[model samples]
Target: MPNSTLHPLASLPNLGPRTAWFLDEIGVATEADLRRLGAVDAYRRLKFQFGRQISLNALYALAGAIENRDWRSFNEEEKAQLRAKVEG
Candidate 1:
């Protein structure tokens, strides 16, 4: 059984240990924190902190987690939009 008190980000789909660690490094400890930061801003922080260590997939996963969807489920257009947001 899963721990009842696990951080929501830890339990979210498409996010794994590495991603959780990255989120932690960026000070995102709770679901509320992630929600407040939003995926784009969160990705920006990760990029700013980790630089080339972070990937676009991390952005996809963050967005998927926020929307309660799988990262792989994102269509090309959706992925493009995310890329644009990150680059914009």
Candidate 2:
């Protein structure tokens, strides 16, 4: 029921129409919804349903959007640490 035009999740970098649709199908329809679910659960669910690895690119994008940080500005080490925290 959420429209991409008005959804903040749609504004995330690298999240195309297909990815947005996939998120919506999995009950993530808004930025707040995504934030509520958080990165770990979202990544896990995406992996479970899609059978594809959740890259740090996607995880950082989602986390940055949720935390209001600049995704691209995060250092590789910081990103790796965050990913490690989430994965474990």
Error of 2 at 14 (Å): 5.3
User: Candidate 1 on 24-57: residue-level lDDT in tens?
Assistant: 8899977788989999999999999999999999
User: Best lDDT goes to which candidate?
Assistant: 1
In candidate 1, stretches whose alpha carbon ends up further than 4 angstroms from where it belongs are 1-7
**Clash count per candidate:** 0, 0
lDDT of 1: 0.87
TM-score of 1: 0.88
What TM-score goes with each of the models?
0.88, 0.73
